[model samples]
Target chain A: MQAKRVTFPNKVLPYLLLAPQLAVTAVFFLWPAGEALLGALYAEDAFGLSRQFVGLENFAALARDPAYLEAVGVTFLFSGAVAGLSLALGLLLALAAEKAGRLAGLYRTLLIWPYAVAPAVAAILFWFMFDPNVGVAARALRGLGVTWNHFLDGRQALLLVVLAAAWKQVSYNLLFFYAGLRAIPRPLIEAAALDGAGPVRRFTAIVFPLLAPTTVFLVVVNVTYAFFDTFGIIHATTGGGPGRATTTLVYKVFKDGFEGLDLGSSSAQSVVLLAIVAALTVLQFRHIERKVQY
Target chain B: MARRDGMVERDGALTLAAHGVLILGVAVMVLPVYLAFVASTHPGADFLGGRIGVLPGPDGPANYAALVGLGAPPPGVPPIGPMLWNSFVMALGIAVGKIAISLLSAFAVSYFRFPFRVTAFWLIFITLMLPVEVRILPTYKVVADLALLNTPGGLILPLIASATATFLFRQVFMTIPDEMTEAARMDGAGPMRFFWHILLPLSRTNIAALFVILFIYGWNQYLWPLMVTTEASHATIVTSIQRLAATANQEAPVWHLVMGTAILALLPPVAVILAMQRLFVDGLTETEK
Candidate 1:
């Protein structure tokens, strides 16, 4: 955060150092974004070569389109559910593992293994786990004579998506939360107990407050992952399927860009999605990240 | 230690239930993979027959061998081994290139008093915000323009140079006392020498952390690779498996083969995490100064 007077050697050196990164970013990131914005404004035919500007047209289409509306609804539900559930589960597990004392590290290690698996592969794994015909759940449920159908029910599909998302996230959050919990002075909890405060009361007054900042940061990261990264999971598993029950915003983006090849409309969707995420991130930085404390 | 009114009983019950749930939670997390393992060892019939139990089957060796040896080609697609190899090579190439570039850039920024360091750092930082999806199409064109599509460069070029690694290594470097840097510089160590001998050794664990994460990121890659590569020959393990599943319209995918391929891709990153378990833990556990 401090300023150092930079020499031309320093000046050119950092640029030279940063040049490849900048080119990659520009080509891969900035260019696509700018093109997406432009694509949003202009209609493009197949082959992505032909184009014509149609101001606000794609946005209008997306606004009124049934698929887009449903995608928006599902996106909100998915992000909200995944974010909240993962936080609660992560915090609960972090508390459990942290309290295990000497075994905390090992427990944490094994517990978070799910997070280390690739997202697409994990989705595939869950697909097998949740498959109505072949899944462990299905087989075991039938073994107990309790029948379940995840494919038919919209809620079931969304629930599985949320669970899958949370499964990956809980481990990730536990990493941070366990560290946060470990940082809490044992003397404080000891003093709370010494003062006759019960576990629940002590957590409510002290431990929860101490854990707040970590929760806030995790919320931001979890929500971001929900928005962007976990789409592959949903794409692989539900495919915004069972009548588009699980399609999120990113799912729609993929549908538009790759599947539909409606670059203009998809680019518009991307712009809107990017705008929403950016604004939320700015909110996190301005309000939450600031309020978070050690 | 502080036993008042059977305090162990009170806290102990909660801990008991918590461990119960935690153990259950871990199982719930791991069981599907367990299924994958079991399924991988059995024949396609047992899997498609919806047999969940791991009744001893003779398919394990056959399936793993077929997957590893290109034993026989499926009807529409090629054998699995070459496809898996393509993915393996791509992951390794991307991982190695990314590490080299990131280390050089991270080193230059952390140790040198070069100009525009802040600007250069921030520029790279911007890429972290603009993830691959945002830049994906433009990058597709960047590759296309360079005639890199279907080539490893198309995959490797856009994939290299992470902003996260730069930030992570910078965090590690910042931990080293300035006196050490001064001492090394005073020994007339030039920039590259100092970076190799002094800074690198001190931050091996941090580098390992970056290696583990980056390798997993590269190895698990799906979307971009799917887009960049249009042919089956170029498919990564993910793509090959997806194609395997997609074509099994009348019957389920050969479960053993698919899971075997998944496990193959699963091995490298899991190994990185398991082998570097201590370093990964310590890297994450190290206190921020």
Candidate 2:
């Protein structure tokens, strides 16, 4: 734990090694964040040349802009639903697999397969299923009775986006939750069972509290996942479609930047998104302090 | 934590219920992949049938052949097969590069003392919170400015220096006994040699686990590739698959074809998971999975 001697060369070695990565992150990430924050506060011309220092003009513009306001509302609902669903499904699966014994490994592997399938592929796969005419799901549902088309209806489109995203996260959630579950001390569980506690009770009281930190960390992560990572899928799958009903925050950012060609608004939204994430992350560290005893 | 008397009094029903839920979960998780595989086998006609065709279809060869239709056969610029190669190449490059750099940096930070060591490590972790979305325009500007657009360098470079690997490697390296390092040093092993020979090999399973995870991560990436590359030909396999969904219309997206392609994408990761299932499970128990 203690260094024998601290030489000047030794003092400089590690910093020298980390310089490349540190430099890249700073220039590409840190510098950009600072620049983007500046850009967000300023208005820009049509060609993306900044025109003036507008104070909080962009944030005010977002507050009053109908599309921006709606996007924020939709963002919360979509992200919340996805995070909650994935958490529930993932926890259920993890818990079950934990009790699967010798077959637990098999279940865990199988469960995490979807995560490895990648969001892009997952989007395509689900797109096929929800394909209007001959998509397998549409066909099967129509064959039995009910007909569903995500492309035409706004409500269905929103539902489809949530389903597609939430389903894709199941495996990733399972991977972490399964890891967290597996790490739980067996003795505690055994002791609980010996005391005649049922699985549900034991889970609620013992396992859940222990998993609070992981769950909280995942909540922050999952919220970020829903917010940021789903942009591509939403772009590829729904295209914010049927209407703008499915346009979440990042999707709106992409739309403004790439599709609408309004780099300024997109930059503004991106800045806002970053602020939200930073705040949540700070809250996570604070929460982690209380929960992550190990 | 809770009173379990009711469950014990009821005998083994709780166990049965637990297994039941577990089995059901396993089924749901595996269902899509199975469907994709089966759809890959069947002719385009009955691909959507309710009847579960567990066996491979006779058209497996034709489907795969159709997929990889090389040269002038498919009558297009290219088919789906090449994208898989691109995905693999990109994923492998990113995985290897990220692993090597992170390990070296982590080794430096953990074993050797230097000014700002803690600060440097913290700076790396800052990226973990800063998802690619936050700095999309900046990174896009950086990549586009460098003219790295549509190249492997463009796709892979942005992810090469990851905080996750550094963070994980630091944690792993911190666990190594310093006594071993001192012993190696006493025997005339210099810092570089000691790190290369001893510490690296000692963390074999950790490295392997990370490599597999990273490989999957790269293979499945979408947004970054989509942003960097303009050419469909240059697209990674996942990109191509996503492009297919985008281009396809209201009709169920040629479910059979899309799912078949998905099956192709799933193969490498599934194979990795299957091959390294034991190591992964062990890694989970001993470290963070």
Candidate 3:
């Protein structure tokens, strides 16, 4: 909120500059969010003929709805898996790259471009790779005496979507993790080494502890990513699945609203999602606040 | 002498292990695209023949040709040419629109004192938490009511109203020394003039870095464009790639050409990342900071 020491006195010019952004926020972000909250309280007839105010009916129905519950469970499982796998792999790769000497830059380039690939496109690449009939990976799995068909098997479908989502995210995690590693002071590592500690001991005692802040930041980011960004992966590959097996909460919102034409329930779900995001944002900001204090 | 030799041996082994792991990581990341590219080059029957070949084949040119409009339109899917154009336009619009509005707003909030400025900043900050996915229903309704369906403006505008770029620019502007502004004012420069001449040039790298990020964000949009653009003409390459995969020729789902389109869909954004690696990395780390 701090302004320049020598500031501009023209109020009208400031308002003019702020107008476009304010207008867009009001119409697109603020208005839709308000509507979602308001619309969640009402129920409309399926035929678009009638409407009635049902204060918490939508919420109650969502509670009882088995599919909604399933979607919630799946979202937790998917996000936990994506965040855990991506973070671990990213940390490993970052450590390796740090020790890789001259080849580090090449590996970084090869590893990072996937972050730019669309999640939908990433899903397609994996979809083709694991397709039952023509997919080489599928054939390889079959050769090892395992059945592989996401199109028919729900668990397989969930695994496919998880892998694709995690694959797309690994690049992002690697960048942050590597940057975090680079920020660690070198003398500490050398001192630990001079104490006769091996590489693993050095990492556990020194590097890992130092990377804690970065790891925490990446955790919040990865969870938010797995929760929202994987909509593309689900939509492109599984379409929420052979039987809603891979349907995360965000996917369920789109399906229920757009595909099912159940607007009231969808809006209620939207409100629920908005609340979750607001909570996550608060968490991230709290971390930022702490960082600033330091 | 023995201790020195042992230390040298350990260093050599450690370096070798590091190289091994990094290479494996790179391979894991790249192998899927490599296989997809190989699949793109092979004949359709080769994929359907069970167990795809691992190397490039003779069909690359033909498959790409059919995709980019040298051949008949594949059944139920449009050619990739128009869709690519649409994606380009939408991405460009989003990058430019976001930069223009965000730069102005950041300038306003950081440089001028005004009523409700903190409230405005907080309002924009709130949008950071609510992605378009969470509020799809009502937002779609708003777009439909505005008759923006099947139009590029609808696809570009709502998504561009992001606080990420605005917050990024604000952070950049804060780090700029106030002496620059004071000097400009003493030189008889107006606020807009200073912004146009001094501030704009100074933030060129930030702008370029942001452009790379926003362009990718816009180009890779799936759900919003999927909801809004129903017409084939307005279809983006990312959305259209989904359509292509979902509606492949009934019997076998033409894996060859679908892979080709997939490659096309990924190329531009990947090229941007590779071309501007330094700026992209700086922008990414800076924004998150």
Which candidate leads in lDDT?
3
lDDT of 3 by residue, A1-294 (tens): 676666788979998999999898889888999988888999987776888899999999999999999999999999999999999999989988887766788899989999999999999999988988778898899989999999999999999988998999999999999999988877787777778888889889998998988888899999999999989899998999899899999999999899888878999999899889999888887887787876
Model 2 lDDT at residue B217: 77
What does chain B score (TM) in every candidate?
0.85, 0.84, 0.93
Query: Which candidate, 2 or 3, has the higher lDDT?
Result: 3
lDDT of 3 by residue, B1-289 (tens): 4322233224778878888888888888998899989988887777655646688999899889888888665555578888999999999999999999999999999999999999989888889877999899889888999999988889987887868888888888888898998899899999999999988998999999999998998899999999999887899999877767765524655788888999999999999999999999989988886
The sequence of per-residue lDDT tens digits that candidate 2 reaches over residues A106-158 is 66666665666677666666766666654667777787887788888777778
lDDT at residue B113 of model 2 (Cα atoms): 68
Candidate 3 docks with a DockQ of 0.59
Could you tell me the lDDT of residue B288 within candidate 1?
A: 18
lDDT of each: 0.72, 0.74, 0.88
Give the DockQ ranking, best first. 3, 2, 1
Q: Which residue ranges in model 2 land beyond 4 Å of their true spot? A: A1-12, A143-145, A175-199, A283-294, B1-10, B42-57, B70-72, B75-77, B250-255, B281-289
The residue pairs that clash in candidate 2, if any, are A131-B252, A132-B252, A135-B252, A196-B4, A196-B5, A197-B3, A197-B4, A198-B4
Q: Candidate 1's residue-wise lDDT over B33-122, tens digit each?
A: 777787788877675677757444667787777777656643444566667677777888777777777776776676556557687777
Each candidate's interface RMSD:
4.1, 4.7, 3.4
Deviation in angstroms for A265 in model 1? 1.0
Task: Summing lDDT over every window of 10 consecutive residues in candidate 1 chain A, give the lowest-scoring window.
Answer: A1-10
The DockQ figures for the candidates are 0.40, 0.42, 0.59
